[model samples]
Target: MEPVNDIAQLVVNGLMSGAILAVPAIAFSLIFAVLQVSNFSVAAHIALGAYAAYVVNTVLGLPIVAAVAIAFVAAGVVGVASDHLALKPLRRHGPITVAIASMALNLVLENMLRFGFGNTVQALNIPVYRDWVLGGLHIAPQQFYNFLIAAAVMVALFCLLAFTSIGKAMRAVADNPVLADIKGIDPEFISRLAVFIGMGLAGIGGVLIALDAAIEPTVGFRVILPIFAAAVLGGLGNVAGAVAGALLVGVAEELSLLVLPVAYRSAIGFFAIIIALLFFPRGILGKR
Candidate 1:
């Protein structure tokens, strides 16, 4: 591959990774949209999902679909449970307080995993295939598969939000909680539902990541910045924005390798956040 093609390949790879990141970004956006709280525990849920899928796929010898399902359920259940135990009461304290509490919750959950699973890294039991070369670009089979899965999840979520009655109610609550209440929507129910789905999506994202990398306690933390960057860049609380931000950040991070070392790639998210706050403020695509 020529220099141009190398850059092209990086962009392609970035897009693939970005798609995976979008799942958690949307998760964050969903929780924030409905509850107005920054539930950073999405990171721990990501790790939990990866570990859950690991148990199903590696230990139980189940298939990928089954593992994915297990990941979603486990992470989601923990999400709702943890919220009920720790963050629910703090909700009334405001977004900053809830966000701080969530950060603490994140450490607690992460430490719990470390204690139970230890610091060892684990990987999913799956077949690896050779990469396909297209126009001098290398596309890995696993990555393409992950991208497809992510796309499918996003489509399903959009359909739910656009077509389903519960989805509509959820959107109503996000749009205007008081008006939604006046219309007989149960805010509390919607909040739990959002956290369940949001954290579940985070788990799925972790599973996809684990397919390509090792599953460790910090799996979610490793990419949390990009996920958060994508959410903030897209406009906090804006689902569509999160997806867009993820893709853009993914591409930018890939392209960054052209100049900087791989160790610095994570810093891209911080720069993105600073840039968004400096100019976009409310986010590039978020409401005014």
Candidate 2:
């Protein structure tokens, strides 16, 4: 019974963590589906956003809310810049070239952070949002807030894709870029929007981590693999799939603590991915 209770607590923790993971996974799938290239620098972009927030809060003595806002805007701008400066120039070079460029840029950003921030790990020191007791669960305020925010964002994104003109245009571009170009959809502009949104998602994800705990300069480096796995499992370009995959991975990872040492908790994701690939190569929802 005690072990079972511990498993339950772990599941709660996983859900909390997975809620945050959904943001990046969704962004990854969004870009991969629409642009046909993995934004390998997603981790860097998110880290930069968190660092920007940290700077604003620490150096400028701004509130956490204000710092997050600034980070959000800055991250979006960086995403747009990536499309314009790197992906755009190589649009004719195919996704392989774009992915390579993204990876190169990621390296540049990671090194830049190391040079600027040094090797110290820093905590944001934001006050925890709230604490609530519901049923037998001890729920942190941030968990509820994050879950609500994630759900709202997902719903809003879904509506945007389902009912808006920009959404339709983006869909057209994703489906057939040449046709979209011939139809005057401006694939570059659409792609820029996707990149910006994707980066924004990554940025907010970082903020969530900062809000939840301490952040290190190299933190985002650890985020990429799991996020990609979640995204792939969710189905490429499928937002719903991303969210579902995140939840599943989070729960499984958390529950694994029942038998596995806590030290190897992070390794669970890798093991799960391997098992998932072997059994369901198309992932939980199938590739989009």
Candidate 3:
């Protein structure tokens, strides 16, 4: 491939990765917006999903798709469980209290995985689909599929939030939990649903990451920063912001390779978030 073609490929790959990150970024924003609490233990759920995929694929010899599906379901369960056990108890407290609880939950869950999985990196072996190259741009089937999947999912989410009563209730609760409750909305139920969607999306992100890279005990920790940065850059409670932010972060991270070491690519998200906040303050969309 020509140099220009290589750069194009890199850009495309970055966009694909960005879309994957957006999945969880949107989820994170949704939960935080609705519950007014940031679930720091979201990292744990990501790890759980990846590890679950590893187990099902490596141990049970299941297909990667099936394993990922199972992992998503499990992550949803864990999200609901965490809300019920760790977060619900602290709901009356300020958002800071829930954030702290999330941090604690993060530690507990990470330690548990370390104990059970032995602090090693596990690779998920998935068969590759055919790749297509056009006009010097290389398009891996999986990466293209990822982009399609993410885009479709985002569209579905938008439609759901726009047209569904539950979606309206969730948005109402997010805007004002107290008023929502008085208006007959169940804050607890909304919170649970938010958790379910957020963590499930996080799990999907994990599955994508695992598909692209090795699953390590520390993998979730490594990804949390970038994903969080994307969420913040997009706007704390805004789905559109999350998608935009994820793409921006992804492109920045990839293009940074021109002058900076590859290791610093991950830091682009933080820098971008800081800069975006410095300028927009309320975020790009000013949702919250």
Candidate 4:
């Protein structure tokens, strides 16, 4: 009974952690799918989202939902601006150039955040901190909410990709931008839209993470490694794959606690990334 309970608890915690990771993982996958660039600025966007939500929720005394919404919109705008101002110009320069530019953008955003918000850790002041216990499992309210929200967002994204015209256009562009342009699909518009949605998801993820733990300027950099591992393990350009990869990594990280020191938990993700790259370069779900 004790072993069963412990296993169940670990699984629960893994799922919750995976839920939180799914958003950023999906964001990374989306940008990679369309642009073929890692968009290192994603980390900065996430940190900015958390700080934006913090200001709205703490300084302005707004509700958590409102703060999250503001963060989403703000991040989306930033993403669009990034594409237009930074990545768009490097379109003819190749993927490596674009990636380098994105890294520079990330540095700028990180410094801006540090300058504006300082280096101190901050947390969201949401009113719900209670946990829900079912049988032998304990789940925090925010954890449960995060799972539901992540699931819903994934579903919505699938629907958008499956049923909407814009989604088809995006897919077409992803497969072959030159061909998509020949077919009258605007690659530039699709790219901007993809960035907007991707960063919006990142924003939501940032807010949820801040709700669960304290956040600082460096929080973005800290989580980017795991998020990248999940993306790579799942498949760089596959959104569904990213979610599955995130779950696997999350579970692996949590279960590692049973045998490894807590400080080494992050090592699990790095190990997974290394192994996956060696054996399955395309990832678990990536196309061969």
Candidate 5:
């Protein structure tokens, strides 16, 4: 392929990957906005979701939709349960305390997954399709479908946030918890709900990644850097910024292949973090 064709294909591939990454990045930022914690345990929830879906999809031979539902529910349940048991008591101490506890919780959950599933790679039971070539650009059907699904989820999320009372309450809490509390909104309830939704989205993100790549205990960890990069690049607590950040990070990572070795792909995430911190402290779409 010509250089132009190569660049076009890279951009398309980047968009596909960016769509998947955005789901979890939004989860991260959404949680941060309301809870003011990093919640690194999100990585474990991603792997947990992938495993849940894998059991239903491969072992029980269920439909992908069923698996996705199970994945969301399982991960959401674990997320809230863990938050309550481990991090909740520490909240009054400080966000940093909770963050550290969350990292410990992350390690515990990931290790639990390792104990249960072992260190083996598993792939989803989806049919493979050849890439479609158009004007010298190749597009994978699975990736394209995943991108559409991601877009739909984002739209539904926007609608929920815009039109639903629960969403409005959530926004209120994110903006000013004290004010929301004064207005009769339940902070504890909102916190639990945010954790559930945020971790559930992370689970969906796991499914998306596993659709094309192998699923394993470390699957989520492998992408945590990029996910964090996306969130930080967009503005840590801004949901909309996550989507934009993900696209830019994805495209930047893919384009790096032109100059850097394939093994150095993950370096883009680090680079993005530095650039975001140095140049755009509030992120590209973040509020000034």
Candidate 6:
């Protein structure tokens, strides 16, 4: 009975963590699906988003909602800028060139963050720390909130993609940019919009994480690999797959704690990625 309880707790923890991870994973997958470019700078965007929220909360003394809004808008703008100033111009240079450019941008953003915010860790002061206990299981308020918000956002994204004109256009462009353009869809505009949405989602994730845990200049770097693992495991560019992969990775990481040290928990993501690639090269849900 005790062991079963432990397993349940682990599962709960995994679900909570996975909910937080799904946001960025979905965002990363969205960008890749549309642009076919692995934007490594996404991690930087996450950090920037959190920092933007911090500024709004600390410097401006705004409410949490305002901070989150600022973060979302700021990150979305950065995403669009990256696409226009760097990615769009380098389109003809090939994926490798674009990827390298993104890496450079990521470095630049990270350094800028470090210079401006310093290397100290920061936390958001959201006044919600109560937890609910159910069936001998403990659940933090933030954890529940994170799950709810993530789930809501994912559903909203699905609706946007499934039932809206812009969503159809985005999907059309993703399926075949040249064909979409020929059909009167502006591929460039769609690409920018995709990046904007992706970064906006990342910003929301960053803010949630900041509220739940301490954030630092390197916070984005720390989670980027796990998010990538989730994206790859779900089959890159598959939005629904990314969420599924994030949950799996989160559960796997939590379960690994039974045998592995806390410090090495993050290695679980890398292991998952490697194993997935070896057995399922196209990802569990990735279409070849």
Candidate of highest lDDT: 1
* Candidate 4, poorest ten consecutive residues by summed lDDT: 123-132
The estimated TM-scores of all candidates read 0.98, 0.89, 0.92, 0.95, 0.97, 0.95
Report every candidate's CA lDDT. Answer: 0.94, 0.79, 0.83, 0.87, 0.91, 0.89
Q: Write the per-residue lDDT of candidate 6 for residues 31-65, one digit (tens) a residue.
A: 99999988888888888888998999977889878
4 against 6, candidate with superior lDDT: 6
Clash count, predicted structure 5: 0
How does model 4 score by TM-score? 0.95
User: RMSD of each candidate?
Assistant: 1.1, 2.4, 2.1, 1.5, 1.2, 1.4
Residue 85 local lDDT, model 6:
86
Off by over 4 Å in 2: 1-4, 129-131
Query: What lDDT tens digits, residue by residue, belong to model 1 across residues 99-157?
Result: 99999999999999999899998999999999999888899999999999999999999
**Candidate 2, 42-142: lDDT as tens digits:** 88877887888888887788987787678777888988886677677886898889888988888887788889898788877566665786656678987
Report clashes for each candidate as comma-separated counts.
Answer: 0, 2, 1, 0, 0, 0
Model 5: per-residue Cα lDDT over 115-196, one tens digit each: 9989888888989999988887899999999898789878887888889999999999998999999999998899899999
lDDT of 4 by residue, 51-146 (tens): 989999999999988987898888889989977898889968988898889889988888988999898888888767768889968999888887
Better of 4 and 5 by lDDT: 5
RMSD of 6: 1.4
3 or 5, greater by TM-score: 5
Runs of candidate 1 with Cα error greater than 4 angstroms are: none
Q: Give me the displacement of residue 106 in model 1, in angstroms.
A: 0.9
